[model samples]
Target chain A: MQHPVSEGVLQRPLEFTLDFFGVGEHHLRAMPLSSPTAVINAAAASTNRIKLSTAVTVLSTDDPIRVFQQLATASALAPGRIELVAGRGSSTITFPLFDYDERDYDMLYASKLALLMAVNTDESPTFDGPHRNRPLRDLTIVPRPEEPLKIWLGTGGSPNSVHRAAELGLPMFLGILGGTPEYWARYGHVYRDAWAQAGHPAEKADIAVAVHGFVAESGDRARATYLDYEHRMMADGAAELGRPVPARTDRAAALGAGGMVFVGDPNEIADRILHLHGLLGHTRQILQMDVGGMPQRDFLRGIELLGTKVLPQIRAELGTP
Target chain B: MQHPVSEGVLQRPLEFTLDFFGVGEHHLRAMPLSSPTAVINAAAASTNRIKLSTAVTVLSTDDPIRVFQQLATASALAPGRIELVAGRGSSTITFPLFDYDERDYDMLYASKLALLMAVNTDESPTFDGPHRNRPLRDLTIVPRPEEPLKIWLGTGGSPNSVHRAAELGLPMFLGILGGTPEYWARYGHVYRDAWAQAGHPAEKADIAVAVHGFVAESGDRARATYLDYEHRMMADGAAELGRPVPARTDRAAALGAGGMVFVGDPNEIADRILHLHGLLGHTRQILQMDVGGMPQRDFLRGIELLGTKVLPQIRAELGTP
Candidate 1:
């Protein structure tokens, strides 16, 4: 049983990013892990405190009942520590891969999210979604979690996604690829306002941020090291999506103060997190440290610095015990 | 990560039994495990040599693509050690729970099995099964295994199941709940004959057996301990199925030579296994030791005896290294 220190994940851990963005080839080359919930179950067996989630489950292409069942079983292994971050996926590859029509994306996500929420809340739920041939009439989903699982709506900051998440009273997990703290903060405010308007408690309208990042002994080293890997990832990813690759200068700009990428030294990364927290007021901020098949030594070092150096500084700044 | 020795599974392991036979209540009470492939992934993280499989993955109601993906991920965790035993589930509860008609059982299993086999063989399979709304035209499945997975057709000795398994050229996993060696051997021969008629190689026509069993220091003590639990399991299971409970006299008869339940001392269990092997010519035999909410201590001890005492005897009798 490897610890997050030995494996991955620092504090409030979110691991095993599942996506359809060149997932068949490039991502497979980048990481050995596959099938998020199953991987989390294995991680659940080893860890005691770190919250495990399927970073972003492509909920649009997956069966929500099976997802719930898998997560519920993982929760049994590590009770009260399992979570789910579902997304309608940024890539269109999954629809055809899973035999789903791309045209039904919105309907698919909406209906599946509804079913997932229903199954999460009730063991015996009757769902008549378009995905199913017949209505499930009070069918029991076994091995219910000890408590209701914390489900987050993972979004790339589309207005519909934010409003839908808020309306459903689900927490928001903002995935920031390239955007300033101020830019992301607007979505947070919109989500909270919509959540309150939808009659959900203000306290329950929680938010978390996910971003591309790395940390090293110095800011220059961190940025320099992450630059090539991030560029390669972007180039390969763009090619997969049949889009023009962004220039290295644009990638570098994303690592700047007004940018989204959070690469820097420990102190710099900590300050960046604090700044984001002040703007977004998010409870958690998880970094994608090992993007584009970065070396394990660098990735592990980044995680070590984040946990030991960066997180403590953020906690101190936030007045958290 | 817990080894099979520490957690469960003495030699060849089949942990995490997923069945909807009163699964919502009774089975949850009996086992902490749920969702076979997910649990197997957790087990895969720890063990290397001991093979892990989802003991009879209820295939009829499940999405074969998802199952393949999950199993393939586990294969990544423990390459060449992950296998799948897909069964058209004995219980009918999964059908309603997963939003499928029980009337479509034959069609569902047959079609899903076809898709699973195709995905196992080809990474980009074009499947147009009845279960799917549209055809998957050479859609690529990610993280292909280094080798094609060993898929066994799990059955309770139905003629149709036997023929289907043989016709598909899949290995047979005969599940013996209550049948004599001679009675079960007839199905093995039928399967082998069909395999030959189907033009499959004789060497590749492998068969494995599963039975309710326990091992103890003495034959009387083994039977005495297993009797109440097996009877209780049968009673609860029968009640779940809306069938009359088998009499204790009948269960006791099953523990005897001419019956299916293999319960006795190490020597007694070994002899029974050998006798059955001689009749059936199976490659492997797995026991359902912990049945009817049996105590962990007893189950653990049974596994210990099986690994240390019984397996050695079988090996010696078979003259294997």
Candidate 2:
């Protein structure tokens, strides 16, 4: 009789992706933001073990209590498998919807973020501030998780955001999709330096590099697939800016090739990740797989291959998990 | 051989108490606010299917996010088993702990409560405010139960609190434990009048009356037990207040005859409840079964007898569930 395999050994372990930075149609089209439940449940069901994250659940356009509540519930359901990368989201739709001005976005985020952190603590937190104020009410969030929930501020290369995160002693998740790998290195350096200057605890600051990636047997096939998606996304992004889509090859190539989209085989993809890691000293890297209506099957295959092949090699090369 | 029992007949039906209010030790002690989880869980597990409620959870003293998280989790575990009676809890502990002052408490509750309701909505909420602000963040609370979570503001005869709850379209659970039943009648009138003035849809305002109770076969036996517990509790309460304990009295006779404590047989208990209901227009009543460490067994027996005997009679008489 053939030997039976154990469930643990034979189970098809799917790779996990950061929930924050999925490159789906919603992210590219800038339509109404999609419900976070679908992606969150997908991560929970799959064997990916990846932290479900939101690259930046913009605080400016979002309610902090709501954000924390939703995220906290998701975290409870999944348990040690979620991260929140909070930022002032890019879309201007929130300003008009909430009757808020862009000028006050910074102050709004600062105050709300402070209140959010304070509220998440063990004690019933009361705060008096410009944006929000509560009196001496005894309150506490119920069903606090066993582990303290992790919150990362997703910064779009903003020094103030970086400094704020450091001052608050929260981890920084840099959005490196728009800039070069070298720029990430500089920002990472500034983040760490600021963190040090702020006299935070000795725990090493964690940095996560978020960028898009696609892989195939051949480089040409990967490039073609990436370009088809990139073109549409760039057009939509340009429309949001009320500017004509720039046709310049150099600009397009710079945007495409500057560590944002890694197109190649496993070895080549791993190499690009390593290069970015080297520059930023980032141990965590989020490869956004579903950019711009890329087929779900293709995305799954990429994640599968990354988990099966690329991640192991990258970890070995980096000497870390 | 015995015939097989039908599925419906064989099933042990679930039992429930229509409504009840619980006093948190935090407010009773006036120092070192107790953990909400401990208080809530203790009340939930210890009490029968009575609607377990915190007479008022001081929202200003604690973090609304944490409170909601805990309450949501508790509700999920119990399912129609928990009701949150939120208030600007009476105490100064929340201020120093959360670094908040008394002045900001009202706005804090207003903003946080708004955000709490917004987040629980189906659509992602966009909010802007001075104290607690969130932009148009696409988020949803996960593991939300099938039933609408019951949220009540514990208004201690405050028209503003009652008006706020009506304006927000939430229920108000009044705290009418301290004074005469006639006082509650005025408070109820004010709440209904404010509800009308708010011009919102007329939703039922749940006025829950919390009172102390004692029961025995003989009135004399009940009265003796009641006085012992009352005198001890009064002394303990006075000690906490840093005031001299009042000389003991036949308060058991006065309050019992005054129809505050239901200290008599099952018939008398039921009658007292009905009279209070008529006086205050309250449909729900929570008896403080365990008053100042009256024997646990006695407390359990008192509640058990009430559940099995007094409640059915009260229900039949009042035409309520």
Candidate 3:
């Protein structure tokens, strides 16, 4: 994978080698990795075992049929290894750029999500919605996957979004940028409760969490490195988007077990992950290690530590494969 | 490359090995290779030397910025090796499927083509057109290509399209499905005349030709093989699209030197290609060897002959690299 650290922003390749432990996904945030399907498809050509996905494919501004076709084509290259996480993007940049109105954000997301799911499951799907200029009657989105794509509803802590995912019987992916692990666990309960209310099986209600953090050889290095980069990332991102710089979180408090940021050595990080897993009962946890132009070596060392140190401890303690 | 013959329609990979001689492209017809950028990106991951392209991306129904981003992303995978051929598609399947009205076909193409060109050159572009829900004011399409993508104006012999390409200073890709070399040569003259009249340098007026063809060990074998599949393809496509089967062209006449089809042995095919080149002065010639349900072996053999025999002969005779 040609990492963004090598090519600069907006050209980052999603490194799916993390699929050895779990799936690796790239989200469309600000100006980076905007063409997630294209990057995943390119990565699909070379990697065999890794599962790749779009963490959040800004669904509101995109054509569902086009997204379905791109993912389906990528699946052809790497069968059974493609997944999609559709979200009303956290960033509103796409609405203006794609000629959509921000006022219709939720409405657009709901309409497009229905169409995306319909196209995934039906060979000839008929759908009518405000999102489309005209109703699609029995249109076949071509290059259907041999297996239907596994779609996750991505949300940034919206109760309505969680309920919609449950109602639709999709996996819920939580994008947790801030808040304590205990605080974030409430969304998982809400999702599962809604899933059951919607008459879905208990086993089917899956939840995944993504957080901003890093791991290093020592707790001191990890905390210091992550704090420096995370703060810079917030400021740089805000500046890039012409938004006000966000207030920085307390470094010591955030790195504590009560907070969401997961920076620490392998042992400490593993313990925190397990604690969060117990509270949320989530299916997966992804760490955003590289932020704010962090050097490749530091980011890679974090992944190495997560894989070689963190995962084994978590698996051993959980008594799972 | 995960050829569709190996998987099945709409799942075909655009084979780019032809770039040893020139670029390889896939066109979106009724249902085959519809997501060209995804396939190209996947192919780009494995191949180093082959130039990949969408011969005719149905630009009328697609968002130009999205198309640009997808192609730009693919270009990052294989820098300086991605090309886009934009056309008002020959098939009308996409319009209804994408919720586009066929009444605005030419208008949509012209508007989108302008935006595509604008984004390719300018980092921030402003535009207004009937095609857009709202006018774009200086929107920066993300991940601009390191090098501007080679955009070819694809036309199935439309005079207005030829003029547009010339006036825009873009290369013209003539999709010559059927026409005698002598007759098709007029388009080249027209394109060059307009290009020069529009004040573009003479050498920059490039013309590329794509035609239905097949090459076998013998002229009789090639003609019979291509005819059988071509007939089946035409009938199948018509039935699939619910259009009337097109009137069959005279087989002998089509296979003859004065005809467009280039079916024959390598020696005969080479001679015919040279004959066409003499008339058209085209920079690139791509043969559509696989049609209908032609076996993979036949397609591979045709490509093998084109690379090993036809290209070598043509290159030697032309005395140009």
Candidate 4:
């Protein structure tokens, strides 16, 4: 008797809402940053089964206490449905305005993560570091959620960040935009190996990959729309990195075509995801359906299709439970 | 009609709840140094109407991000009721556990506070400090409260802390269990004057004092309880400072007799508060009703009496509308 291999699927679809505050567009009217409470409440009301997360909350320039409290509150409000994916967000505006030196990014993230993890524990922590000291007090954080909050470190193609997350026993969220799945294989290996060496339990290291996705009724339409959106996004990202936006269409196409973007129908998109998963061993995949001037309605429709059609089919094929 | 010269009583009853997660006791528990979130949450919820604070959250030894996030979340939940009254919390446990050098206290607070305040602003902040760095991005803190969150510097009779708070336009909450109210007056003046000179509005330089408060149905019971609590607290404080608890019964008697503690009724407590207000010029006062395992029932009763009877009289006398 031949047995079919089970393809991996998330127990249920995890719902994550990208902040509506449009980024990278000069013409876009900046929306107010949504409150953590507002985001958590909205996510809670929208889906009963999806895991809610902030794509990446900037940690380097933020107060750890506030972040912990907000996340904890959200966790309490939605029990096991919330997780915080934090990063030294890609913005220098928070630094100069807050009067922080730009060189301490790595140290800041390290220290902040350490402290954040400590404070979430059951004991009253007394840390005396280069930045803080305090006597031991019987401290308690209020409105704690039912489950321990999961923290994922979001890294923009940084190996050190991946290793650090492993060292800290935190999950890793890798940004794979503008890169091929083959590029992330090394990071995945490093993370898994580090977790093993650290003696953490098996499955302690979780890896998630984020990719830009655009699906349409027809392949040609999807490709065209994806190219348009990709061009604009690449230009903005390049400019933000202080690099000139590539003027040549060939260069733009080259950058987007093989990168972690899926511009096709259900089967094609699913194949791309499976290929990346095979390479990176990532259980969680975040698809950015809306990017760089993509119409909101189209984006929503794409997401709906991905959730209702593509994801289920992929799960069955992959034999994911 | 000619009105007689009447002094305006300022009864700014600022209730501060400092969670002293007894470092020694927590260490004894064989748990990690982090304080339990439940305790903090309970305290925050319990003191809903008061100025909820961590007397000195001891930032030097902890992660600023966690500290800020936790407090910010609490503040958002409570709106204007929360204040992160942080200090270089006393205790060396965080140093070894978190691998911190003792010399980094000043740098840590300054950098952390700068980062915290920057993130709290409407604009994306930028900073290039020795301890941290980030490029400008369209970053904004999610879930900011409607009212501005207050950050108070908890000072251990340190003039530098007072000046720092003043210079930064932040408030100061002084812990004054051992010193005379007169000692804080000089610091208070410096803070106010510095704040004014720093281009802050006149109303920005607020000062709060945290003191021990004990009230009883009878003067004798109050005195006995005050003596016991004060003795143990002073002894513990002295031990922490590497000094002997002072053999000064006369001073204790004077304080008790003069209404610093061991007070009779609501009226008497109110009168003592008025006197302290005159001496310290503190607009907000946090009274420590529970000291050294004082019976929970007694503590609750004292709180009720103060909130219902004592506060009303004091507010009325102060013409607080």
Candidate 5:
């Protein structure tokens, strides 16, 4: 699946010290955004530093062995610089495509995740599960990376996903779209509680969230420009799902009232990011800006503004150098 | 599988136009050389321009979809600069590890190669081979590269391997590890005949060969040094196969009588390379020098000599830039 938009992003070089790098998902059928491993492999080559991440790589459909090996290969290029954000992704096309039942979602994810962890924990690995058609016996994943990878669970503020991450003692990445800052904050509490209940240390538990964001000369200017682009993408996405598009005007108003959409001047955008950091206490904050055929120059301008102004302001507010 | 020798080789930067690039096989358990794809991916990141290739990525045991995907991913980083030299590797470890029946070797390779070609040929492709457990419904391979990869069939001078390459209309890479240059030259003729018999044009047939070679200050010095290393490696290899090591004296004499091992001074090595090129009419010649824990500095020194001296001499004599 070759998506024109995917090529633009896959070819985008990480020119700065962006702590967490990520590629978005298009599920099984998205032409341009095929698998995250493909883009992440290219990302490994383009950037000397910065983590290789997936906003969400659907774990439910793909075989764990293949995913682990692929991620390990990407990480081998730059050990400790890759994170696989495993998720269901937004598209439902994978079930029929992979010959998987939709009802087996939880069991499949758990089984695959189990296999992945088993393979990683030993050089000569053996995995057998009902989900696997055949058992893998004494297999060694090649290109042994220098260190273990930090694979985060990507959740859409789903309770099960939050609890799964905590139960497994893995890091969590919350996709904070379509929600108020406080609305998603409850998941953070749930995740921490699950982690504590599961006997994992709070210090070791980590959370990261991604929210739609943009920065311009002024708050009004940023919102006005971003809203049109957001509405177009949302409408297209809704149509693809055979759902009626929610009224864009009402959606915009709701986002504006909640400060959920991080579209504003540098100061205002940074303030909301800080506000979320305070509300949810997320260890990392990723701003999803470029999407839905936004003009490359315009998207790049947003990136420049976000990096040069908003990021510095946020870092200063957080007392980080 | 991890071979200690490979790491030393993998770490070397391809600073010049040296012809046969490849990875040696160590099978599943060899701790050091796990798989060629892993090394090739690492090679992809480290080298620029010179073709990154696997000496033989075991095609029978690995998933064709995965192999194609891996190579495609590696090539996406350096489009048109990567070649996958698919081969039935020397190690027999993969058969049991991947649950492949030894009897199905030829059929497995054929079916997988067919699927790989099918996937490479179409954007949204579907393949349902009898050997494959399930039918694949129209699935698109990811990171569609800029150009179709030049996938060469690697053969150890086997007639079947040659016929398969010819029948498939693919280029052949002959791995001539032992025997005299003229002895190996016969396979080149066989391959050409097969290419013609298979209804492929003569001009379409291409061959490349790799041999054990070393470049030293002098012929006498090179032979004296190379023999000890060769004998040690040969003895270990024979032990692995439960066979007696060939007499070192006879082995040395056979190599000296013919232009097999190109271990000598730059002039001597260059002359032999040209001599074999004349005999086999091969378009490309690759020399593997490092073996049996040759000191990293010495191996690198051999590489330096081969590139700095032997290559320049060959190019000048060939009257090519």
Candidate 6:
């Protein structure tokens, strides 16, 4: 899953400078805010609390050492609040931009992930890899963060990805369009089983699922409002991934039990959340309310409904309140 | 002359993040915060006004297109408040890190600077340069800024450097250790002459000067407080560049007429500023108060003195509000 969040923060650190100047006073800015970590560093200056993470940093086409340094620097600014979710991004623009061949995706991701892990684990690492400029010896990355960061493996239903996360004992995050929660929940089980078989503690296995959805005051309103966006999204958005946009007549069935679309009012959405919880036992759930040129007012209303209505009901039903 | 001010800004975008956090209630932290542009991007979120710039981005070992994007992104965030001062940094570490040889420094800098200008000017560019991975064609950078940025050329004292800045028709900035103002002023004359010869408007030529200085209540106290730090800085910092630090006995003499060091009471420092202005005719002057690891309280005091006492006198003398 090319997480929209990670890409935004990674690519648009300079975006915040407007806030610094326009919003209030005494705001600081960074100069070269091109990379994600750099955005985090600049964020450190503007805020006191709030955990920062990349939704999914594309590991296949990036330099692991530099990536580690970037995250480490942010750690220095805001200790214990930095996390990284690594995956192959939704787009392939980075491959040619960074001078990498798309064919090497598998080997590149694995090798870069290994290097990132090594850099985090050891102060001085000596590695002979296809990507290294030279063998490093006892080299140290500076402005050392006060604490180690948590790394989450981001995947989009690839079986191989689940095994890789399990083998690494990394936390897992599933990103996708809304689909069969019951079947998708099985991927979590796969991760858990592999993690347990790999000798990791059973309790360490965790999963987070993010899907496209919206919350509204009424079930009908939610469906009607989201239908148009869903239609456009499925038609053009999924076209690149080879997923056919289904017939509009099937929308109702798709929102039923074990369906992909999650359009409904607070109660219906809460019920769906509970259903997914019961099936998958996911630790966290995220909803993407804005997509395919969503209007700002509708998006804001959806957010308000989710926060003030749906979430409270979900919490109470899940026995978490 | 790699202006120390630009170098400091380019290299330490991370340090400023602390200010963003510690000074306020609603702020954020970044993960990598490694690059100057990223810091600027994050800064955009926190502020609205105040021109942000890279003191010196070391263009020789960096990618100009990416650099332009970094600055451009900040421009989008902060609008007309973005500036770039480009220079070759004082360190040689980037040569090996970026896979460039020392021998190609001159050619690499010229080529890269030209590429940066091209990307800023045209939406699509095709080039066959020695450093490009491939010829770029019909590409558009995202978040196009509101206005063109102001780019300044930072130089220390190299004759060739002066000619390059003049030929490029970019504003010139002089960075130096305490040097004779009358002697140093000659570089400005040379730049103007070269700029005129290059057919640039005479009124467009501009110069800014920066040097080491400290302001206190008295000359004796200033000398006493800054001596040990100066002694250590000269000995260690000079050694890195293969120069010998001056003797302790020469401190007072160095602060006299035709001197580099600017240590004195606020009135005295103010007098020196006007003195340099008279000789060098610099439009702007920047003083470095903290260097060689001086205590924070002392550095803060020096800044306070510069603001409260030195600046008032200097402004009054110069007849500027």
Q: Cα lDDT of all candidates, in order?
A: 0.76, 0.59, 0.78, 0.58, 0.71, 0.63
Off by over 4 Å in 5: A1-16, A24-35, A38-48, A60-63, A70-77, A92-106, A133-139, A227-250, A257-260, B1-14, B23-48, B73-77, B95-104, B225-254, B257-261
Q: Better model by DockQ, 1 or 5?
A: 1
Q: How would you class the docking of model 5?
A: incorrect
| iRMSD, all candidates | 5.1, 15.9, 4.0, 18.4, 5.3, 10.2
lDDT of 5 by residue, B1-321 (tens): 233223445444365456546765453322235455655655665566767777777787776666666676667556677778787766566675555687788788888787777767665668877567567664555656677778888888777898889889999988776788788778878888888998988998998888787877777877877767877776776664456877766557545748477778888888888888887788778777776656667777777778788889988999877
Predicted model with the maximum DockQ: 3
How far residue A87's Cα lies from its native spot in candidate 4, in Å, is: 6.6
Q: Write the per-residue lDDT of candidate 6 for residues B83-148, one digit (tens) a residue.
A: 676777655545654446778887888878877776677645565566665655444433345665
In Å, residue A72's CA in model 1 sits off its true spot by 1.4
Q: What CAPRI class is candidate 4?
A: incorrect
Clashing pairs in 1: A1-B1
Candidate 3 on B1-321: residue-level lDDT in tens? 344322431222234135622223222334445687777777666566667788778899898888888888777777888899998987777888988999999999999999999889876778887778888874566676778999999999988999999999999998887778988888789999999999999998899898889888887977876887888887887777667988776677888988998999999999998999999899898888778878877777777778777888888999966
How far does residue A315 in candidate 5 sit from its true spot (Å)?
A: 2.6
Runs off by more than 4 Å, candidate 1? A1-33, A238-249, B1-32, B225-227, B237-249
Model 4, residue A156: distance off in Å is 5.2
Kindly report which residue pairs in candidate 3 clash with one another.
none
Q: Give the fraction of reference interface contacts each candidate recovers.
A: 0.49, 0.02, 0.56, 0.05, 0.16, 0.17
Candidate 4 TM-score versus the reference: 0.57
Compute each candidate's TM-score over C-alphas.
0.90, 0.55, 0.93, 0.57, 0.84, 0.79
Q: Please report the candidate that would top TM-score against the real structure.
A: 3
Interface RMSD of 6: 10.2
Second chain of candidate 5: TM-score?
A: 0.89
Question: Residue A182: error of model 2 in Å?
Answer: 3.8
| Model 1 residue A209 lDDT score | 86
Greater lDDT among 1 and 6 belongs to 1
Where is model 4 more than 4 Å wrong at Cα? Answer: A1-172, A178-206, A214-259, A262-281, A288-321, B1-153, B159-170, B180-205, B214-271, B278-281, B289-310
Query: Once superposed on the true structure, which residue ranges of model 6 sit more than 4 Å away at CA?
Result: A1-43, A121-124, A230-257, A317-321, B1-34, B46-48, B96-104, B230-254, B319-321
Per-residue lDDT value at A64 in model 5 = 64
Q: What is the DockQ of each candidate?
A: 0.42, 0.05, 0.51, 0.05, 0.20, 0.21
lDDT per residue (tens digit) for residues B102-217 in model 2: 68878878876765566555334566555544444543333253465577777766667777876676776665435566766777777777777877554566566666676566
